[model samples]
Target: MTKLTLYNNLKTVRAQQKLSQSKLAEKVGVSRQTISNIETGEFVPTARLALLLCLALNKKFEELFYF
Candidate 1:
């Protein structure tokens, strides 16, 4: 199987929205470390979480999680 590469778009999206990691985490109902892990490519979100993130960031799912 092709290992999915988790890219760090959290920082960019947060910056664009003028929000902090904690703030975004609260909005997404996840821990700040979870956000950090996603941002650092240490964790891969589930399909639902990925969709939530895309919606929160006002970005496309592909844009947020794909290459």
Candidate 2:
């Protein structure tokens, strides 16, 4: 089995939108620590969370996450 690495430009996008980690997390219904983990590649968000992030950030799925 292959171990896949997921990649995201979340920090850049979040900064571009002038949102703090806590703010984005709140909008996406997650905790700030979770957002920090996600940004650092320590956590991978579920499908629902991904969609929520897109809705909140006005980004496409591909534009945010990929593996």
* Highest lDDT model number: 2
lDDT of 1 by residue, 1-67 (tens): 8876666566787888998889889988999999888888888888888888888888987677665
Compute each candidate's TM-score over C-alphas: 0.84, 0.93
lDDT (Cα atoms) of all candidates against the true structure: 0.82, 0.93
Give the Cα-based TM-score of candidate 2 against the true structure. Answer: 0.93
Off by over 4 Å in 2: none
Candidate 2, run of 10 with poorest lDDT = 45-54
User: Candidate 2's residue-wise lDDT over 24-66, tens digit each?
Assistant: 9999888999999989999998989889999999999999998
Candidate 1 Cα deviation (angstroms), residue 13: 1.4
The lDDT, on a scale of 0 to 1, for candidate 1 is: 0.82
